[model samples]
Target: MKIMKTVQKVPGGMMVVPLLIGAIINTVAPHALKIGSFTTAVFSSAGVASFVGLQTFFVGTNLKFKEAPEALRRGSVLLVAKYLAGLILAIITNKIFGLSGFLGISVLAIICSVTGSNGSLYLSLMGTYGDSKDTAAQGILNIHDGPFLALITLGASGLASIPLLSLLAAIVPLLVGCILGNADKDLRDFFSPGASIVIPFVGFTIGAGINFSLIIKAGLSGILVGLLVFFVGGGLSILADRYINKRPGYAGAAIASAAGNTIASPAAIAIIDPKYKPFVASATTQIAAAVVLTVIIVPPLVAWMAKRYGCPKFDEQKAKNASLQES
Candidate 1:
């Protein structure tokens, strides 16, 4: 049907299309796909946990130690910048609205939604507009896939306290993947590609768990959160890339979206603190909507920024080198 080709034409179509379809299916006929064991397992929220764990493992396998240094450097700059911006939002929301949340948005939801960046989207944009080091930056940045960042921010902000073990448990899949991928080149080769391949399943699973009605309730707020992340996070990241990394600033803007995995955060937090349970469903839908919103908007914004304000240092150096050769 050329569906994939059509979807590919969109900036984040690979993940967004499946998520939307899954949401529609879940919304229209919640039990229509539960016809069999396999369908029941794959087409429901129960399946999301499994897929996320596996997808995380695959993402981990792509993190080779060889890429660690540059990845850590650039990744940390972007992560800290994005995280702080989110933390500020959390604090503001707390002061203004309190933990119960304001206008259907919880402090936990806002922090969780904004802190996670879409690694695939960032890497895709980096591949198009950046150099090798930029691409490798995903290594450290990818660690935000799960709930650890939100938990940490909550704990640090004194809004919620999490157990030490839960924090460790959050990273187990990533650590395991890194170990396996580093230990065997064959394993890395086999699983690294699966990271991208598994994204559709990730999207579908996230969507399947979401109730579209919740999306309706969180619609405007979700879009607002997405915009906040895209502009504020992008701005913080661009400054870091320019001043901290001393590179073109577009790499920071490239990380402007909420990762699809972040749709799971509120539920994860609810697991730790029952106080958060009431907010989980709505937060999931909100984050899911935010993921779609950012995916649609961030890539083009990054491309435009790169073209207009990209650091000329690298390109100018290439120009000089070319002229010297011509002379």
Candidate 2:
């Protein structure tokens, strides 16, 4: 029916709608997807990684041979700006709160919230607002996920290395897609639809991993942490994109989201060092709220930024092909 047009009208609807739907299911029944067969395989949390990886390969098909360097620079800008925002959050919170933490939010929450992003959500948002190179930037952003940042920031030692395999998992598929797309232009066009096709499924998979109830569990501080993740972390990332990366701020706004898995960082960090133990539960809760809030918030923020400054799309070839077909 008119569903496609209706969804396209919303800000990041292709991703946000399915994500919210999945969240609703998860919060309500939670086990409905566990009915087995293809239902569980595709709709369950188990499918999130596969969907994300597939989208990455398809997005790579859009990037050409020349834009690779710009993607690296764009990624670097986002990486630095995102991490600096988190580090600043830690320092400011430490100065004002003095380790007791303000409200229910704690150092661990800010550390985890600021240091990285929702890579899957970033890919989804990029599918809407970003160019091929913008999507390629995700390959470099693999550094943001996991407890590595918390461990390093909290001064915990000897846990794990830089996750080389994670880097490879990100880069390899993109490179393969790039080589093939460059070799056959029509193949790029053929596979490009896969990027959008996978968004709803991936969004749903990611949402299945979240529980909106956690926001309530976190209380007012939970909401505050979400706003901080959006304004402090998301805002600065936007600025970096505009000023440093020399583009519209959509990509930066896109990355401000706290990954759903980031909820576990507090406990993981506490495992490494007992000093962070007392704060783990509260921090975990606050981060969980941030994850939910950011998902609900950042897509609209990116959409607004895009509407105001113009969408940062880079599909001139696609545009040209469409024009030729019309003629």
Model 1 C-alpha lDDT versus the unseen true structure: 0.73
Candidate 1 least-lDDT 10 residues: 156-165
Instruction: Give the candidate number with the greatest lDDT.
Output: 2
TM for candidate 1 is 0.64
For residues 200-275, what per-residue lDDT tens digits would candidate 1 score against the true structure? 7766765675555654666787877777778777778788888998876888888888877788888878877788
Evaluated at residue 95, the lDDT of candidate 1 is 92
Each candidate: what lDDT?
A: 0.73, 0.86
On residues 1-327, what C-alpha lDDT tens digit does candidate 2 reach at each position? 899899888888999999899999999999997788899989988889889989988988888989999998999899889888998889888999976578877888888887879999999998887788999998888888888876777777477678888789778889988998999999999998999899999889988888899989999998988888888888899899999888978899999888777778888888878888898888888888889989888888888888787765534546778999999
Per-model RMSD to reference: 6.3, 2.6
- Which runs of model 1 end up more than 4 angstroms from their true locations? 1-68, 156-217, 311-327
Estimated TM-score for each candidate: 0.64, 0.93
- Model 2 alpha-carbon drift over 4 Å, by segment: 157-159, 314-327
